[model samples]
Structures are given as structure tokens and as C-alpha cells.
Target: MKSTARIKQVLVLLVGVIAIGSIGYQLIEKWTLFDSLFMTVTAISSVGFEEVHPLSRAGRWFTIALIVTGRGSLVYGIGALTAFWVEGDLVNLWEKRRMERQIAALRDHIVVCGGGETGRHVARELLRTRRPFICIEIDSTKEEAIRKLGEGMLYIIGDATTSDVLHRARVEVAHGLVACMPSDKDNLFALMSAHELNPTMRIVTRAVAHDAGPKLLKAGAGAVVSMATIGALRLASAMVRPNVVDLLDAMLREPGATRVQEVTVGPAVVGQALSELKLQERTGVIVFALREGATQRHVFNPSQERVLQAGDVLMGCADTEQHAALQRIVTEG
Candidate 1:
């Protein structure tokens, strides 16, 4: 039974016993309401308090019965209450219900699988960007730690490889999913389940082995990242191009530092020329690449004469304020 239900049952038993004792004392001893209640309480609690009035033979027998039955019920009820409070079950239940409601209301959110190093980083980035997301961690210990780490982040403690867990996280309404399970097989399974649930969801998975990358892609993953390979490449780049690495690190670590971001061209800018838009001059955002909406082709350092398309995506680098301005200019007009 659920803890709440068990608690309710215990409460009901205690109340029933007390009520019976109170009514029995009133009928057998002809005591007033207050005196009967006081007598019943003292009998059940065994508080060594004297009776409110002298009891007759029938009343004494009834008091004995009340003490025998009510004491056990009262003790059990108190123990149950103490256990529930000490174990944090009530707080967990409340949090679980609140998270369920939030998950049900979420749409176009990201679902992150696993709460390991990579998954935590993904969650933290989403949090920093103020994006909606849910993290699924199978390990209860890790889930608790992740909950403490991300104060307001939504998460579920369940095996991500299972379709039921994914559904619970509302993968059907999610815009994307990131599978960062330690095992490549688990990541592949999660990706396949998510793909089956939401065929259009963009899925990115981590591969422990190089061969797993192709399999993950064939299983409907949009991108398969190999952390080991990336780490090796980054190490090599740090050695060969120290200044470039330093600049990249600075962009990620420093506040207000220029970083690359993507903004989509809205309907208002459909037929405008890149030169006319003048994003560089207005928002200090350098448009480095233009991705065609229909063909999914990218034009690096797009020509000024190129006409902007409604669904085209512009990749540029800018500070926080500049990025916001560019987004407003693209989306608002």
C-alpha cells in the first residue's frame, strides 16, 4: 500500500478505537462527554492519571478492553507517523507529484537520459539557458545527488532503456533527447525507444565505442558523439593551437563573452538581402553561416547579396545582449 494510504488506515483505526472507548464510557458509566473523553484518553495512553470518576464493574471491564485494543492501535499509529517523517517519504511523495504535473504540462522540452558526467553537463547547460528538460537516472543515489545539485531541475528515477520510463518523462512531446548512459548499449536502447515513441524527435547519443556510433545512427539517432574521440581531439588541439583553445575556453567560461548561437530567419525577413539586414552593424552579431531551410545546405561566410529565406538558420557569434538583440530582430521582424 502507499504510505499515505497506510497512514490514513492507521489514523482511522486510532480514531475508531478512541470513539468506541469514549461512547462506551459514556453509556456504561453515565459520565459527561468531557469526562468520558478524558477517561478514554487516559485508559488508551496509560498515562497513570486517575479516572475522571469512579467506574462500576461494567465500566471497569469496558476500560480494560479499551486499554488493550486502543493502546496497540495508538502505538502503531505513532510509529507509522514517525517512520514516514524520518524517512522523508512524505516530502518525496509531494516532490514526485509536483514533478509529474510539470512533466505533463511540458511540451517541446528536452529529455536527458542518465545522470552521469555528460548528462549532468547537458542538464546544467539547459538550466543555464532556461530551457525546459527532464533528466532520467536509474540509480537512486545518483538521482538524489543530481536533485541536490540542480535545485529546480526535473528528473525521474527509472531505467531509461525502458519505453515506460521514457513515456513517463513525456518523450512523445519532447523536442529532443540526449542519451548519455555509461554503456553504449543502454544509450542505443534508449535512443531506439525514444525514436519509436516520437519518430520526429531529434536524438543525440553518446557512444563508448567507435563502432556503436554507426549503429546508433541507424537506430534513428540524429547525432552520435564519442566522448573519448572528442577528448583526444581537444587535447591535440590544445597542444597545437594553444591560443585558439584558450579563446574557446574563455568564451565558455567568461561571462558576457562572445559565443556562437543559431537564430532562425522569420517570415518578415524572407525576401531581405543579407546586406540590408545588417545584423553585424545593428547587433554586433557576426553571421558566419547561413543554413538553407529546404535543402539543409550551409553557406559559410554568406555573400551580402544572398537573400534571406524565411526558415534559414543563421549561425553567429555574439555576447549575451547581442544574441538577444539578434534573436529579437530575427524573430520579431
Candidate 2:
């Protein structure tokens, strides 16, 4: 349980016990409920108030019992309140404000929704790449688990489906959003909310069900990857193409990891081809393939005859610096 909830529970239990004890005293001692409650409160608080009436033998014994129980409850309640202020309520509020300030200053950062296995993996990759990002998780336990693998990551403990949480995440300024919540419905909802918040924002998500791709896309996801299907394909590839699988594993584990990027054609590269671009010669990068409209073509060793178009996407292997250069060449052209 979170400290806040636990403290609330303790306080409520104490209040209930005190209420019941006061009511019992009123019934047995023939005292008004208010008087009985006031007597119990003073005795428990050790406030040294005068007695309401004379005490018979039975009343005297009852008073003794009430004093012991009431005093203990009073002390316990005060301690719990003190601890709540010091450790739970005030601290959480302070952290929340600090996180908000940090998020407001972020730009070109990724927003991750959910902290499940897939989300965690995505976060780890972002951390490894030293990218700026904020994670949103509904589950406290899962949030704790992700925090354990800390890399100065920021997190907001709330549902990503809410506009308030997205706003706090600085969605309008974020470069992209990754929705990896467990349910396809949740991921789709989060994508929709994020897109509505920032129309031009890039959103990538995972769908639990294979057929949920179209729905997720309609909900504003730029890319919807199905984990189930991908897992199946990975298993099949590992069995039939062990060497290929091993190569991929090695690429991920090695330092200076390689990532495949799609560089779009920019104004400056209007009439340029993969061969003419000379990315390989200039940046030690390779153009693996090219896409124009609905067609994809492998241009491992492209010829100068190929012309670049405004909307064409180039698939290439490169590092961060090369990728940035590719972006500059395509967009700033």
C-alpha cells in the first residue's frame, strides 16, 4: 500500500474505535452522547478536564478502562498524523511539483504510457540512448519496479488516458509518445488522447490483439506493433535462422548499438539518389532500402539513375550523428 493510503486507513480505524467507545459510555453511564464523547476526548488527550458527574463503583471502573484505551488511541492518532505530514502527504506533493517543473522544461522528449514489460523495455532502450522521456504508470508496484532501474527517469503516477496527466507530461512539446500499456484498448485510448493533444506528434504503440492494428491507427497511432505476432515470428526465426537471431542479439548487446532509421526526402534532395547522396562515403552509413508510395525497393548499391521524391522514406543503418545529418539533409533541403 502507498504511504498515503495506509495513513488514511490508520486514522479512520482510530476514529471509528473512538466513536464506538464514546457511544458505549453514553449508553451505559446514562450520559448524553456529547458529554460522553467530550469526556472520552479529554481523557484520551490527557487535557485535564473536570469530570461531568460523580462516579459510582461501576462508573469508576469503566472510566479507568476508557482512560487507558482512549489515551492510547489519542497518542497513536497524533503520531500517525505527524508521520503522514512528514513522510507521505507533504513529500508526495513536493515531489509532484518538482516533477512538473522538470517536465515543463523538456523538449524533444518521449512520453511512455504504462510500465509493463514492453513499456519497461522501451524505457530501457531510451535510457541507454540517453534520450529524454517521462513515463506514466497506473500501477504503483510497476512504477516502483521501473524506478529500480533508474537512469534519472521522470515518472507521473496516473492514468495516461487523462488529458491532465498528458498535459503534465508536457505532451504538446514532446517529440513522440509510446503507448505500451497491457491492453489494446488502453494503448489505443492513450494514443488518441496524445494525438488530440498534439496533432503533429508521433505515436507508436503495441496492440495486444493482432487485428487491433486498424483500430489503433484510426485512434491516431502512427505505428502499431503487435507483440504477440512479433513474439511468434521471433520464436520461428530463432528456430529456423539461429545465426540471424544470434547476429541480431549481438547487435543489441554490443556497444555503439546500431538502429535502422527511415530518412524522408527533403527539398534539398529533390533530384538526388542513394548513390548520389554518398551517405556511405561521407558518414560510413548504408542505404538498405527505399520506399516510394506503396512500393518498397532494396537499393543496397543504388544507382545514380534513382531520383528522390519529397515523401519517399529511406531505410538506412546509422548512428546518432549520421542519423541527425540524414534528417538535416532530408528536411532542411
Candidate 3:
């Protein structure tokens, strides 16, 4: 910010000096506007071009003052510019601008707050799923780690709980946000701020404590997950149902590998029986579980005679290409 301010200040001063010099020449020497401008440019730039017209006694003194002031300003401006370059401020500024443009161009992207382990994992999953997203991390030290999440990663280095930072991340156009701040309060604040900025966007917040889940939910977070609780559950599952755990692990272990996904039944596929779609045969997407549109309860291994309705969610397993085909036919058709 200091570097940016310095550059702005230098530019403003230079412009003001040039303008004043041009007007001075026009008045004192009675030169045309073009001649005055040319004289001013040459004088300020130290080109040492001859005078456009013979100078009066007043004009000579005015020219001397202008030369001294112009040279001083140019020297100061050069020093500031050199500092900006040597400090790498110029490159940083350019990259920040490019990132902002990329972020602004996004639609339906996800915003991930924090650059800790949780946020890192979430970003990796979003990357593997091919979702366009941006991250906001307050700690400057965490910036390098965040950038290493992928090539050309989009992120903001600022407090995510603030509305200004969220706006910078384009919360208004985002489809979802993941709040994974280190503390429950920070995550809660981010969730509320994000909701205020984009009421329709789905928000999932991390719970630092097991009991914070309900509070986050009441605060308008679409869902809340406790890392400790999930870890405990996974441990128990690994011991009691190792095979099932292994299967789930295998599904998520690699990019383009078969994985389970939940997609809402779109209007085009609504009212159609499972058998009529032949989803497995057509797209290799098997619909194994159905969440009824009205009931919101899962019916595992629903019969072929079951009909898909609006707002119903289907959970199925398929590889990347197969899932894309399934989404195009059912969720996007």
C-alpha cells in the first residue's frame, strides 16, 4: 500500500508541474498551446531542446525555476520507482490485479476462508472436482501455502470475517462458501457476513467445538462439520467396518476415480421412473439412494419403479467423465 501510494503521489505531482509549466509558457512567452506544451514537455524531461521563442527576462527566470523543480521531481520519482521495483512491489501489484480480474470473471464459484489444514483439504477437493473457487486468508505467512495448493491459485490476503474482504472475494456472485477459520467465532462471523452479502449462496462452516454446530446452523450456515467429531467417527468406522472404510477411501483417493456424488433431480428428469432413464446403461451413473423431495429421508437402493421428482436428491457413484455425462443428462438436461 505504501508503494502504491508513493507511485500515485509521484504521478500527480509530475502532472501538476507539467500543467502549470504549460500555462506559464503560454502566458509569459505568448506561445501557442502546442508550442507551450512542447516546451514544457522538453523542459521537464530535460531534453534540453531550444526555446520555442526568444524568452523575456520574466520567461528566463520562470524557465530556470521550472527546470530546477522538474529535475528534482523526476529524481524523486525515479528513486520511488526503483524502490518499488527492488522491493518486488511492482510484480506483486500486477499479480494481485490479475488475480482480481480472474476472480471477478468467476460465476458460481466457491469461496474458502482460512488457509489452514481444513481449508487446504477443502480447496484440494474443490480442485479435484473441477470447481472454480477463491480463498481468503488473513495471515500473510499462510499465503505461500495457499498458493501452493495449485498453480495460479486465486486468493485474498485479508480477514475473511469482514464484509469488505468477502466482497473482494466476489461473495455476491459466488454459489457457495466454506468458512474454516481456526475459531468457531471467526467462522460464525464469516458465515453471517457471507450470508448477508449473498443470501442465496450455500455456506458450510467448520465447528471448532462439537457443540458449536447448532449455533452455526441457527446463524444461517447451511451445514456445520466438526473436525474432531468427523475424525472420531472415521476412526470408529475404520475399526468396525474396515471394508466399507476401504471402499470409501478408494473412491476418494484419486482424481477421475469413481466417487459418490449427490445431485438434485432437475426439471427435465423429474416425473420419470428410474427404469425409463436407464442411467446406468446410458451414463454409467448408478442411482443407489434417493432422498424424497418432500420427506428429506434417504431410501437406500430405491426400486427401479421409483420416480424422480423436483428437488429430489440422488446419490450415486461414477468416474469423472461418467458423472459429467450423468449431470448433463439429469441435473443439467
In model 1, which regions exceed 4 Å deviation? 1-87, 255-258, 294-297, 318-325
Q: Report how far off residue 209 is in candidate 3 (Å).
A: 1.8
Best by lDDT: 3
What's the lDDT for residue 202 in model 2?
96
TM-score for each prediction?
Answer: 0.69, 0.67, 0.72
Q: What is the lDDT of residue 81 in candidate 3?
A: 94
- Candidate with more favorable, higher lDDT: 1 or 3: 3
Candidate 2 clashes: the total is 2
Clashing residue pairs in candidate 3 are none
Error of 1 at 144 (Å): 2.3
What's the residue-level lDDT of 303 in candidate 3? Answer: 96
Query: Per-residue lDDT for 105 in model 3?
Result: 94
Error of 3 at 47 (Å): 32
After superposing candidate 2 on the true structure, give the runs of residues whose Cα lies further than 4 Å from its correct spot. Answer: 1-98, 293-301
Candidate 2 lDDT over residue span 1-333, tens digit each: 566676777778668767876886777788888888887777667778788776667777777887787677767767777886788678768776877788889998999999878888888878765679999999887867887767456988899988899998899999999999988888877888889999999999988887899998888888889888889999999999999999878766666746777787877887766577777777777776777733654455455567887677877777677888878767765
